[model samples]
Target: MSTNARQQLQHHLRNARYEVLPLRGTLEQVQGLPPGTTVTVTSSPSKGTEATLDLAARLRGSGMHVVPHLAARLVRDSAHLDELLSRIEALGLTEVFVIAGDADNPAGRFTDALSLLRGMEEIGNRPHRVGITGYPEPHSFISDQMTIQATDEKARYADYIVSQICYDPNTIASWVKTMRARGVTLPVYIGAPGSIDPSKLLRISMKIGLGQSMRFLRKQHGVVGKLLTRYTPENLFDELSPYLVNPDYNIAGCHLFTFNEIAKTRQWAMETADRLQEVPA
Candidate 1:
């Protein structure tokens, strides 16, 4: 790798944020993160919004910058938004990620991220930084045009974006180019899975409807089998170095989906950082 590219890789890795689901062993895994590391909690249909908030509160108490996922579909109303903001502030959190969520039906008025974002702005207790999601591939339910429009609208309220998991760097690069052309200039944190067992990875992928990406990987035979053995983010990160280093992309850093395997991910990141440092600049 070129010295400039290597250095950019190090910079992006050092600033990467980690996202974790609220489940058993989450606290212990979170406790393993470096002090002041940014940890975003994911909201689940089974666990609900309260669980996400509780996990964020606990993580904040442990000294991490906790950004809880605020699922718009899960929120009850404007007053509910106010209460959620109050709870997050009381925990000293000033960042949040908004998603449309996976709920089969809306629990309240807000059904999408744009509505929730606008509602938050209207309430006057906005977080210091707000994040919204981006999809490089076409969404299963929403049209490509709708996704673009929603992102453009949400960008008004958001400070940055975390893209959904995409296996192809070429696709990601193209998506970034298109986004820049459309004038959505928020800094993007590319989403990638952390170290995870292959079976678990496959199950998670299936659960989230990432069938196309999974099928592509499966055809590569070795990649899918190796994922079962031990899957790391090395190859993906290396492929992304060009986009990260190039000034035009505005690819801020990584947003790792750790899958609660915090210790392994932490080790991998540290080791990779060390490797990057050794590359002569």
Candidate 2:
């Protein structure tokens, strides 16, 4: 790696945010993370926003910077949104990541992230920092044009963009270039899988509509085999290092999808950061 790339990689690794699902054992794993670590709690249809908020509150109490996912479709209506925002404010949290969500049907008038964002604006209690999703690779259901248009629209209300977990660094780099060309200036946090078990990672990827990215991984020689054995973000991080170092990309840092493997993810991040900082023999 170039000197700049190495330095940038270490810097991002040091400040990376961890995305964790609000499931059983998540609290304990998050509690084990280094103090003041930024953790984004995910909301799912089954768990509902309550689960995400509950986890975010607990994590915040544990002294971590918590960013909870507010799945638009799961939110009922204006009253519900107000209640959620109130709870968030009560916890002294000021960051949230919004998504259209995976629900087959909307539970309220806010069917998408854009609408939810508008609602927040109307309510006038918006979080200090709002993050929206970006897809480097094509979304499973949304067309490329639509995704691009959606992102451009969402950019107006968002503080930054966090891309979906994509394994291919080239695609991510190209996507960043495209976004810049389109005049979307928000700094982007590249999403990547943490040091997760191969089997579990694959399972979760499919469950969360990452099939296209997984298919891209399968095309890479030996990647499928590696996925069956062990998976790490080192290769992906290295490949994207040059772009991460470039100011034109406006890359913020990494958003590691830890999938609740907090300990392993933390170890990998620390080790990689240290390795990059070490002087060569």
Candidate 3:
């Protein structure tokens, strides 16, 4: 954030948010980021619920717009959720992103995102903003029909939908249209990975247990099987640049999956913004 180029680049970003990894070291890194920056914390109870909450409080203290991922499955019950929300509200937090967290087994009775959202509502912890996940492609765990159903339910309770990291803009555009046509009106935030090294990218991808993407990569058998062929979602954004500049698509803003590569991702996004401004819209 100290670079002059980055300070200038931020002016063009009317709406953009950073998704930070919830690990210990990475958490400290994001803490040092510029204030008022909206930072979304990944919610993985498997990663530990206490850590997410602690980080959120810490970020809020830094005057940044801190958003904690409230993994619904981890909440013990309405009482437990109320306590959590009370803590956040105490810190002046106004936003939260809810997800069907990766916990295979429930730490409590709440098992899905809807259950969690409902619990939050019942406990009078309605946040100023709430976000739900949307999958442009078929879900790795559930059928397409089920994914759509889950999305619809989430939409009913969420303020917006942040689509999963997809590498195809056409796929995302089609999915957005389909979602709107189906009456799921939550504005969409198309997610893409920020800048990252190819080797480290694949290593981190594997570390995150990217089941669907790995399946896709493996199926690309004989087609550049090297790890370099892993994935970098910037290509998807390049294709979607047209839609991004269009207002009718209900495209909200950028949601970068940093993969804990904050500095590199910020650099890449600013450079792209600079390049885009140079070209005719």
Q: Which model scores highest in TM-score? A: 2
lDDT of 2 by residue, 182-230 (tens): 9999999989989988888777777667765677778875576476465
Worst ten in a row by lDDT for model 2: 221-230
- Which candidate order results from sorting by TM-score in descending order? 2, 1, 3
lDDT of 2 at 71: 95
Model 3: per-residue Cα lDDT over 196-241, one tens digit each: 6677766665655555555655565433237345554545665565
Ranking by lDDT: 2, 1, 3
Write out the backbone clash pairs for model 1. none
Q: Return the top candidate by lDDT.
A: 2
Q: Model 2: residues >4 Å from true position, as ranges? A: 209-212, 222-230
**lDDT tens per residue, model 1, 1-281:** 77877888787778779999899889988888877999999997899999999989889989999999999999999999999999888889999999999999998999999999999989999989999999887777888799888888899899999989877677788889999998989999999988876788877776666645666567655566665465568777888787887878998888888888878777888889899998666
How many Å off is the CA of 111 in candidate 3?
Answer: 0.7
lDDT for each candidate structure: 0.86, 0.90, 0.74
Higher-lDDT candidate of 1 and 2: 2
For TM-score, candidate 1 versus 3, the one ahead is: 1
CA deviation > 4 Å runs, candidate 3: 1-15, 203-233
True-vs-predicted CA distance for residue 5, candidate 2, Å: 1.4
